[model samples]
Target: MKHTIAEVKISYHPNRLKGAVKITSSEYAGKVIRENWNQGTLNLYEEFKILLMNNSNEVLGLAPLSRGGMTGTLVDMRILFATVIKSGATSIITVHNHPSGKLKPSQADINIYNKIKDAAKLLDINYLDNLIITEDGKFSFMDEGY
Candidate 1:
């Protein structure tokens, strides 16, 4: 008997022209993410997403990683990084919404940011700001000196 392994292939297709909307700062990122978010659920539950970008800070794509209850959501680093790598993004900005309209980063949020930041350093990926989106406004980790 003979056994064969499956072949694995990886690829990335640009849905939009390069540098269509360059990310200049966390505030700009918030605007972009807000436009892509589902406003109907902004204050209904917790959702985590990522903004994938190229070397020039051009938009590559936005991916919703997970959804959870009113309090928190699960972010699997493996899934997050896989999406980042597959998108051919050189940088990533993490975004998550708080239904309670709170802009402060929770301890869990900080922990996640630290893990992603550290892992990004190891993988040569640019880890940008982590934004906490509220119904009224947003919070930036970099702006607050995280």
Candidate 2:
């Protein structure tokens, strides 16, 4: 007997992402996005907080927020702030992937970015950029300015 696609089970090993690390360039960011992609037909969208050093451009930690469908990922301001505060980071870069393989930032994406930016300002945590990665090896928003 063979298991059909619908019969298959999938679970995300959140522990596999423990011990957060750094993300330097967009290339490195792309690599991170690729790792979160699911093999199933459904697209995998993940929110990450990239912590940076105050003086230099060194990365401190890469914290994962939520992982699910494109419209399903809910980014909580409290969680985001707690992660950054605990990490003692002064600045951060936000990243998310578009499973449709298009790097364009939708209106909702822009709204989220603005909200995050506003929240970051209150906490004095600089929101550097919000990146969108596609399955076709292309990136948008941060590079082209959405």
Candidate 3:
């Protein structure tokens, strides 16, 4: 008997990188993330997104990873890293929104940030920032000394 093995294929589009939005700071990242976010749902529920970026800090794309209730969402580390790796992003910025309009990183948030930062270091990817977006503004872990 013969067995067949499935093959994995990754598709990358370099053309999209032209004139892409560049993330210079957490403030700019917050603005960009907000622009791409669904305003209708910004205050309704929790949503997590990842910003895939190239070496020049130009955004490749935004990937919505998970959605949850009003207070929190789940982030799968394996899926997160896989998405970054597949996109060929040299760095990443992770963002999540709080429906309650609070700009604070809970303890859980810090734990996950540490995990992601460590993983990024291991993979040689720059973990730019972890942002918590609210209706009013954003809280950046990097800016707050994560």
Better of 1 and 2 by lDDT: 1
Clash count, one per candidate: 0, 0, 0
The whole-model C-alpha lDDT of candidate 2 against the native structure comes to 0.65
For residues 62-139, could you state the per-residue lDDT of candidate 2 as single tens digits? Answer: 677777665546788788877777666787877776777766677877898889888989888867777776556745
Model 3 misplaced regions, further than 4 Å: none
Where model 1 places Cα greater than 4 Å from the true spot, the runs are: none
What range of 10 consecutive residues in model 1 has the weakest lDDT sum? Answer: 10-19
lDDT value, residue 72 of candidate 1: 99
Candidate No. with top lDDT: 1
Candidate 2 error regions (>4 Å) = 1-42, 45-54, 138-142
TM-score of 2: 0.66
lDDT of 1 by residue, 3-117 (tens): 9999899877778773398999998999999998999999999999999999999988889999999999999999999999999999999999999998988999999999999
TM-score per candidate, in order? 0.96, 0.66, 0.95
